[model samples]
Target: MSCIGNCIDHACIKSFHSMIKRELVYLEKFKTREQAIRRIFEYIEVWYNRERIHSSKGIMSEYENL
Candidate 1:
């Protein structure tokens, strides 16, 4: 939904944005644009991808249905 209207719709990005808004954006008050950008970048690159326990990992990495 955030991307162009003609482009493909991705549910994952929407979910991510919602999470970021709830967890990071709502909690912090940035004094400058640069700080906000840096924090968001770090939040995703450092914390979310590396430390977060993703529910999709098993589905994506090892899919075995019995």
Candidate 2:
């Protein structure tokens, strides 16, 4: 059980990192701190966490699974 929990946690972290890299860090150019913050928040809250599909969850968002 503990191992499963750890694996899931690690996977979640890795997925988040990948999402950040792919969606924000690599895709956009931000000239100011506020712009970066707003973009990151929008990607994480509005898109990645809310709308993006996860293969592990049968192509459903985490919010959807919950």
Candidate 2 Cα misplacement greater than 4 A, ranges: 1-9, 51-66
Instruction: Write candidate 1's Cα lDDT for 1-66 as tens digits.
Output: 555873348677888899999999999999999999999999998988774354456443343343
Give residue 11's error in model 1 in angstroms: 1.0
CA lDDT of 30 in candidate 1? Answer: 100
> TM-scores of all models?
0.63, 0.55
TM-score, predicted candidate 1 vs. hidden true structure = 0.63
Write out the backbone clash pairs for model 1: none
Instruction: Give the per-residue lDDT of model 2 (tens digit) for 1-66.
Output: 356657765876798799799867888899999998998988888876674445555686556579
lDDT of 1 at 35: 100
| Cα RMSD, each candidate | 7.3, 5.4
Measured with C-alpha atoms, the lDDT of residue 8 in candidate 1 is 48
